[model samples]
Target: MSKSKQELLGYQSHLIQDNLTYFKPTRTSTTVTFAEEIRSSLQEPKKSISPKFFYDENGSKLFDEICTLPEYYPYNSETEILQSIEKKLLPYLSNEFHLVELGSGSSVKTRLLIDVLFKSQKHLQYFPIDISEILDQSAKSLCMDYENLKVTGVVDTYEKGLDFIEHYDDKPNLITFLGSSFGNLDHNEGMKFLQRINTLMKSDDLFLIGLDLKKDHEVLHNAYNDSQKTTAKFNLNVLKRINEELGADFNLENFEHHAVYDEQKGRIEMYLRSLSEQSITIPKSDLSITLSKDELIHTENSHKFSISQIESYLKESNFEKLEMWFDSRKYFALVLGKKI
Candidate 1:
């Protein structure tokens, strides 16, 4: 583990039986300023920004809405598979393992696994890690619901959170990275992340990951470019975020959301395409850039995987495949494995 800009801010929730502690970040040398990241990204010839920035308050709300859209299948499909197979997963779980989740947004789907873990144990220790303050509310709710469960919520990036926890306790961990968040990383990045997790785990520690599977190009396209244009709004909000936070002059209407499934690449590419030739400036970043008509600023990529591809990823990362649960349509997968 390496040093990060993250520091632990520990506090007991008074409303509960002192069962919840939340860790908030404080400044450190490793912190990267948003302005600097935006400037560098804009200077790239590809003109792309990391999708993680799509989570400004408004963007997060919009994304929550997107999950409910009829055209969006990943959330629903994954939920279906989890509900169907959660009990079946119980036999594979260790008797006394720390329950941890990475990027644990709202912990909506995680409740299934958490509920299952409760079946065998009277008291449990759970950790939910995410960068959002939403974890605060989620932690409180879960604490109230599970009186005997102790929750340690970490508000930090996945890497820093893992670093903190790797040193905190020695209990074998059943860590999960759900909601297909891993798809945001390309193959190399995904492998590297998994390797880091492998380093954190001891033998027989468990991992559960959600992945969207390869499917028809049209289905993928519709999912990201819904008729209601919710995904469009979600995609364009990043530029709006830049304008508000980085002091950028970006006319929201001057760009349009564009998402298309690249069947050859087995991914959905999202972009904000310039509607016309325009110049933009960000005062804080000291940046000015010009875009030609239809010029794209790459935003996100949702990579869909095949079983073989996922198997190779796990095996290469030193994970022994345990089981993979899928929906009837096979549109999504929940792969469970053990660190070797």
Candidate 2:
């Protein structure tokens, strides 16, 4: 059977009700308006919004497009590492494993891992946790073809720290944190994030992490600031979202997308800059904000890592590195660790 048909056959009856709760937040305009009010008020000096907020339905679609662009090396590089190292990674898995994925957007890169795991083990249960509700349908529909796979999705942010941990019975888990999404958090935040995952797992459970390695500034800069301009549109879409849902009068034309490599911070910073001094009104909050020409509203940050840096992080989080794989250019890495 084809993947789609298989998905239909394996579709769980309970998932329909589950997805209702997932889609509830994004359907109402009130949530969007409130989010805008919170965003505008939070924009103090040197302020920034978390990229996790950028995964609304539209933002999620835009991001999927961004991954396909030539300039975005992280997606392709990580996919390569997963595909090439799948055979070796499969041996580490014992029987009847539960596969839990963090930030499992569309499970695009995960298909490679799933294929390998199926070959090694007879039955598998898959849990994909992501903040975007739209991904639940996409992930469930895609994984339908695998007979042994049962997919339960969580639509909460990773910062919630394992809100859905009780969904699975006490079974050995092979958890995956893919796409270098871990890079979104700073060093201290990353350590805490890993420690949280460590606390949830049994001593024998395995964890796989994908990390984008530190590369040339030019290359990293181009990846975020692509020539195709899709990333720019993706950045500005936040404003479009605010305007549509919050009854805000934001002139998308007045703002330009800006992304730069901050050498001192060692991260890629994304901002939306006003072309001229302007005042914008948000109807929901009954507030107006003034902006100076070239003034920026920070949106996102992508931090790069080195192998040694990642290893040190794992140690601090009480995870012992079992194995690691890297691409030829060493621009990306996949590290497998277990609770120490």
User: All models: lDDT?
Assistant: 0.83, 0.74
Worst 10 residues of 2 by lDDT: 18-27
Clash count, candidate 2: 2
Cα lDDT tens digits, model 1, 1-340, are: 1233222322222223488877765545365688999999998989998898998889988999999999999999988987888578878766687788897564578677778888777778888888766644667788788877888877777877776676666777788888878988998999999998888776757888999999988888899989999999988899889999989999999999988888888889999999999999999999999999999999999999999999999999999888998999999999999888
Residue 67 error, candidate 1, Å: 0.8
How big is the RMSD of model 2? 6.0
Model 1: residues with Cα > 4 Å off, grouped in runs: 1-17, 25-27, 133-135
Model 1 residue pairs with clashes:
none
Predicted model with the maximum lDDT? 1
Q: After superposition, how far is residue 131 of candidate 1 from its true place, in Å?
A: 2.9
Over 4 Å off, model 2: 1-13, 17-42, 159-163
Candidate 1 least-lDDT 10 residues: 5-14
